[model samples]
Structures are given as C-alpha cells and as structure tokens.
Target: MEYRVLGKTGLRVSSIGMGGIPLQRVSEEEAERIVNLALDQGINFFDSARGYTDSEAKFGLVFRHRRNEAIIATKSMERTREGILQEVEDSLKALQVDYIDLYQLHNVKSLAILEQVLGPEGALRGLQEAKAQGKIRYIGITGHVAEVLEKAITLGEFETVQFPFNAVELGPTEKIIPLAQAHDVGMIVMKPVAGGAIPDKNLALRFLMDYPVASIIPGMDSEDQVLENAAIGRHFVPLNEEETKRLQESIKELGNTFCRRCEYCMPCPQGINIPMVFLLDGYWQRYGLKDWAQERYLAMKVLADECIECGTCASRCPYGLEIPRLIAQVHRRLGRN
Candidate 1:
C-alpha cells in the first residue's frame, strides 16, 4: 500500500483509509467482513464518530479481536467537559479499546461552535485530560465549514484536521490545508467522492493524493467497495500533469450529476426524496450504473410523486439547485415503478 506521513503524528496512513459512515447502514457481520478485508489489504487507519449510529459499536465487534492491528480514530461533537469525558468513556467501551489513536472534535460547523469547543468547560480541556490519562493518542478537529476549521487550527494544538477535499470542493486547499501544513498538522480528507456522487473513483483518489495531505478516508460498506478503495492505495500513482489538466477540465466541463451534500435544499414540502433522487441520479448519470441505480430509485417510498411545486427546497438550497425540476426529472424517470 502507498503510505503517506500523517504529518507530525509520525504515523504512516494508507493513501485511502476507511471512512466509517456507511457502516451505519450495514450489519455487524457485514461490517466485520468489510473492515477485515480492508485491514487484510493494508488499510490500518479506520475513522469513525460517535454520532454515526452504531458505527463505533459495530467496529467494536471487529476490533475486539484485532485491537492491536488497526489505527482507530473516532470523534465527538460534544463540547462540554463532562459530556466530553463521558463520550470518551462511552467510545472506549463501544470500541472495546483502551484508547483511541486519534480523538477528534467532530463537525465544528461554525466559528461560534469552534470557540465554544476551546472555551471554558469545553471539550478541549476534556480532551487534554483524556490525553493526560492516556485515553487518546492525538487530537484532531474536523469540519465541513472552512472558516471554523481555520479558526480551530489557529487557536488550538490539533494534530490533525479533517475536511472535504474533492474535485468540487477545493476550498480546503485554499483555506485550511496550507495552514495545517504550516503548523505541521495532519489533514484527513473526508468526502473525497462528495459522498459517492463522484463517479470516477480512481480519478478522485489520484486527485486527492496529488495534494500533500495526511490521507483521504472514503466510506466503504461492501467487499467490492473495500477492494475498490484499497486498490487506490495498493497501486497509487498521483495524477500526471496531463491527467491533472484533464481532471480539471472535466470538473469545469461537467454538465450534470454532482451533489454537494450541503443539505441546505432540504425539507421538501412534497416529501419527494430529493437527496435520494439526486443520489440515484448521480449513480446513473456519473457512474452509468443505470440498472442498479434505477432499481434503487424506484424503491423510494415518499418519491417525486408528491412534489407540490412549492419551491421551498429550492429556496433553502445553498447551491441554488432546481429542486422542483429535479424532482420532476426523477419522477419522469423512476416514478412509474
């Protein structure tokens, strides 16, 4: 596997580490198989969070027997002293591990949240106490927002920072990555595929690997997905100049099929599965997995059939996506079934 230095933590993580979100939807046995396959294939770094329902708990089942084999990174968004301590204890118990390799403050969505985390009675003190007690090896901070992440790193001694770094979201490179590199802090890239919206997975890996981040973690729930992600690590070759130019061109040239996962365009008045519609739309439009995507799209219970044309989702969307139009498109394509 191609290993990169995880900045000052002095840990070498694979080019593609396992993201822990998809485990929420999978069975314990299924998660075990997927995680074990990744480890067997040289994925040592496993990232999880307390909020990802049953993810850490499911991982605990796998790690119980292979605790010494993998690097476990988990996070909590809790920003209280007692809550932080309790979260750490609960995570340790859930993972069945004595300590976490990396403990992160998850998803500091705003500058205010960042301050509250480092402020008095915040999670920072609790993290320090946990580190003092040898409960966590390193401290990391993650966020989808750029300003908050930059502010978090500027004010604290975070060893790692996780942010969305993909073809569409290059904000981190311009915002927090350089600062993290300057501070010798690791960058754990999340949503390399924009939560599975990006179709060319290999290209996505090559794109992220071009930058000097610690590693990129993509969620894998099945053996095929595990093999698919681990393949990038096993034979990782950064994009060539021409390939890079081609990728940039592709990004600029995209006519359709990309979901930012901003979730701003939510609360669809029609109960028309907007995100899921777009998700399946992306699967077909980008990956050309039409049959599978079509099947899943047809399974939606509260589908595009209910879109009342109120345009509330469109108003809420940060990207200004045409929610009603997209719902109509999904209804036309998949509503019959």
Candidate 2:
C-alpha cells in the first residue's frame, strides 16, 4: 500500500488506514482476522478511541502478537491531566503495547473545551507528560468543527489534526486543510465515505486520494472491505472526469444537513437511535429501498416518533443538526400508523 509521512511526527503510514469503530460490532476472532488481513495488505495505521467500548482490546488481540507490523493510534475524551494520564495507561494495557504511536485529544468541539485542554492542568499537559515518559510518541487532536480545529492547530501544540472531510462535508477545505498544511500538522481525513452516506465508496475514496492529507481512514469490520480499501491505496489513481462528475452528482443528492453517523448524538435520553433512523431514511429517500428501510425502521425497539423533542441530542451533535426536527420528518415518512 502507499505510505505517506504523518506530518511532523515523521512516521510513514498507509494512505488507507483502518478505523476502529466498526470493530465493536464483530467478534474477537473476526476482529483479529480483519486487522491481520489489513496488516498483510500493508495497512499499518489503526485508529481507535477510549469510548468505543472494547474496540481497543479487539485491536489488541491482533496488535499484541504483531505489534511490529502496525502503527497504533487511539484517543480519549478525558479533559484533565490526571484523567488523560489514566486513559493512556488504560490504552496501553488494552492494546497490549508499551507505547502508543499517536494519542489524540478526542473531540475538542468548542473553544471552551479547547481552552480547558490547553490550560495548566488539562489533557494536553497529560499528553505532553505521556510523550516525555515514552507512553506516547506524538499528540494530535480530533473534532468536528473546522473553526475549532483551525484555531487549535495554530497553537502549534498538536502534531496532527483529524476531522470529517467528505464530498458533502467540505467545510474543512476552506480553512482547516490549508492551515494544517501551513503548520506542517498532518491531516487525517475521517468519514471518507461520510459514514456510508456516499454511495460510490470507491469514487469517494479516490476523490480524497487527490488531497495532501496524511491518510484517509474509513472504518472497516470485514475482510472484503479490508481488501477493497487496501487495493485502492496499492494502486492509487486520481478521479477521472466522468468519475468526478458521478461523485459530484452523488454529493448533490446528500445535502449538508444529512447525518454522517458520527454518533455524537448518541445515548438519547428517550432511547431513540438517531443515526440508525437517518441511515434507514437515507435508504428510503435516496435508494428507493422504501420497503427494506421501513421493515428495519419498524423493527427498531424505539422508533423515531418516540423522540421527546428534548433537544439533548441536538446540543451534543457537532454538526448542529436539528435532531428532533429531522427525526420527526423520519417518523412522518417511515413510521407506521
């Protein structure tokens, strides 16, 4: 697979690295097989988070044995020095590795949180401590807001910046990408397929390959996905004119307001599965899979109509999505009388 230097850290990583979210859904054995297959195919970068349940351990199952073959990266939501230091210890134990290649400050969505982390006793202090102690090699930041990331990168504290940059979510290109490039902070592109919102996965990935980012990580859980994604990196190609047009058409269909399934609006107080509702709704509206979508929508333990209009989910969403309003629309279209 194609390898690129990850910003100032100077670590060479595969252009097509694997994301760790989907690994939570698969069995231990399955996760092992998928990770091993990815390594065999020359995919060396693997990113996970402390919040993804057992995802770190699942990767550990493979990483512990083949630690030399992978470049492990993980993040934490902890905001204080003590909490982040504990998180690093936990991550090391979970991944069965002595040192993490990259440890990011997870989801620094606002300037307030960013300030808190950069304060005297914040997470950045802990990450710096960890780096000094040899627990982590480099520090990075991940978030959904371009403006926040743009500001964070300017401080020259983080070695890399990761944010959503897909066909539909092009906001990062305006400032984050350029500023990151200017600062020599490696750019890691997340949601390359917009969490499965973009239909043409190959074309969507190919489109991102044209950019100067360090890597594009799309979450994968299966062996076929590993092979398909790895092959794209191995035989890198730019998007042809017709292919670009097709991708643009697909992007036009998915307006900016649709869900990217980042799951930040999760654990709804009312037990509603916000992202799943939108996923099914996309199928109903875009793919003409009304029947198939409706069946799954109906099977959901808590339907969209159950949403209490609490506004809690909306407040948590990084994209500023009107969760209650959009899910209400989903209920109108997908819910049964």
Candidate 3:
C-alpha cells in the first residue's frame, strides 16, 4: 500500500486505514478474520474508540499477535485530566497493547468543549502525562464541526486532526484542510464514504485519495469490504474523468439528504441529539447494522421519538433538511415509535 508520513507525528501510515465502528456488528471469529485480512493486505493503521463497544477488544484479539505490524489508534470523549487518564488505561487494557500509536480527543464538538480539554486540568494534561510515561506516542483531535476543529488546531498542541471529509460532506474544504496543511498537522479523515451514504465504495475512496490526507478511514465489517478498501491502497488508482463524474453524480443525488453532523441544528428544545439520531439511522439503513444501530439508538438519553415538531432544528439547519420528517423516519425504523 502507498504510505504517507502523518504530519508532525512522523509515522508512516497507509493512505487508506481501517475504521473500527462497523466491527461492532461482527462476531469474534469474523472480526479476527476481517482484521487479519486487512493486515495481510498491508493496511497497517487501525483506529478504534473507547465508546465503540468492544471494538478495541476485537482488535486486541488480532493485534496481540501482530502488534509489531500494526499502527493502533484510539480516542476517548473524556474532557478532564482524571477522566482521560482513566480512559487511556482502559484503552490500553482493551487493546492488549502497551502503548497506543495515537490517542485522540474524541469528537471535540464545540468551542467550549475544546476549551475545557485545553485548560489546566483538562484531557490535554492527561494525554501529555501519558505521552511522558510512554503510554501513548502522539496526541490528536477528532470532530465534525470545522469551526471547532479549526479553533482547536490553532492552539498548536494537536499532532493530528480528524473529521468527516467525503464526496458529499465537503465542509472541511472551507478552512479545516487548509489550516491543517498550513500547520503541518496530520489529516486523518473519518467518514470517507459519508458513513456509507455514498453508494460506489471504490469511487468514494478514490475521491478521497485525491486529497492531501494522511489516511481515509472507512469502517469495514466483512472480508470483501476489507479487501476492496485495501486494494485501493495496494494498487493506488486515481479516479479518472469518468469515475470522477460518476462520484459527483452520486454526491449530487445525496444533496441535502445527507446529514453532515455539523451540530448547528442542536439543542432541540426537546433535548434530542439531532445528528446522533441520523448517525445511528445511517448505521442501520446504509451499513446494514439494524440490530446494533437500534441498540445504540435505544441507549441514547433522548431519542427521535421525542421530537415535538417545533421546526426549530429545521430552521437552524444550514442544509435546509426537514428535521422533523427525518427524525420521524429514523424513529419508525430504529426507535420505540
């Protein structure tokens, strides 16, 4: 596979890495097969999160033996020093690895949240401590909001920055990508296929390869997906004129229907997490993880069924999506409604 130096960290990683979200849908044996196949195909970077239930352990099963051949990365949502410290220890135990190659501040969604993490007793202190103690090699940050990520990177502490950048969700182009390139920070793209919303997988991945990114991590659950994504890295094909046109067609079809998870349409007077509900629905409808998605949807503090049809979220949505309608659709499929 073609490799690039993850900016600032100086770690060479595959152009297309393995995302750990979909692993939650597979069995232990199947997860083992999928992960090992990825490694055999020369996909060395594997990213997981403390919140993606057992995803770290599933990776640990294979990484334990192939530790030297893999670059393991994970993240936590904790904002405090103690919380992040405890989360890091838990991550190490779950991954069955002594030290993580990269540990990120998971989804720093807002400017306030970013400030909390960078403050005196924030998670940055915990990550700094872990780096000093040889528990983690480098620190990074991941989120959906370009403005928030842009603000966080200006502090000059993060070694890398990850966010959703794909054919449809093109918000990062406004400032996030330029800022990261200017600062020499590694750019790790999370939703390369727009959370499976993009129909043509190869076309979607090829679209991302055109950008100056360290890696485009597309989550894989089956062997076929692992090979398909790995082949793009191994063979390294750029999207031709026809292929680019096809990708653009798909992106146009999605239009505003795709939720970019920018979180501007938040604080639903009803307390509903608008983007999160759509995210879980994407897992069910696009990723074919109905049961897993439903489980997570039910676990949420506020669900889609709680929407009161105030139209406030829809008004705030920059994309002009019919928030209440989409919420109802997701609720029917994944919620108690």
Candidate topping TM-score? 3
Clashing residue pairs in candidate 1 are: none
Candidates sorted by lDDT, descending order?
3, 2, 1
lDDT of 2 by residue, 1-337 (tens): 8999999999999999998988877899999999999999999999999987899999999998999989999999999999999999999999999999999999897799999999999999999999999999999999986668989999999999999888877778888888999999998998888767899999989899888998999989799999999999999999999999999998777664788666778889889988889878976775455776888899999998888888989999887789899999899999977
State the TM-score for model 2.
0.82
> What C-alpha lDDT do the candidate models reach, one value each?
0.82, 0.90, 0.92
- Model 1, 100: alpha-carbon shift in Å? 0.5
Best by lDDT: 3
TM-score, one value per model: 0.79, 0.82, 0.95
Candidate 3, residues 156-189, lDDT tens digits: the string is: 9999999999888888888988899899899999
lDDT string for model 1 (1-337, tens) is: 8888887899888878998877876889999899889989999899999977799998899898998888899999898878999999999999999999999999888778877878889998899999999999999998876777887777647989999889987778786988988888888998787666556778888888889987899888789988988888888787888877777776764433355655567666656657778867765664455666677777777878777888888788766677788768877876664
Which residue ranges in model 1 land beyond 4 Å of their true spot?
Answer: 241-320, 323-337
The model with the greater TM-score, 1 or 3, is 3
Candidate 2 segments exceeding 4 Å error: 256-325, 329-337
Best first by TM-score, ranked: 3, 2, 1
Q: Which TM-score value belongs to model 3? A: 0.95
User: Which candidate do you rate higher for lDDT, 1 or 2?
Assistant: 2
lDDT accuracy of residue 43 in candidate 3? 95
What's the distance in Å from true for residue 276, model 3? 1.9
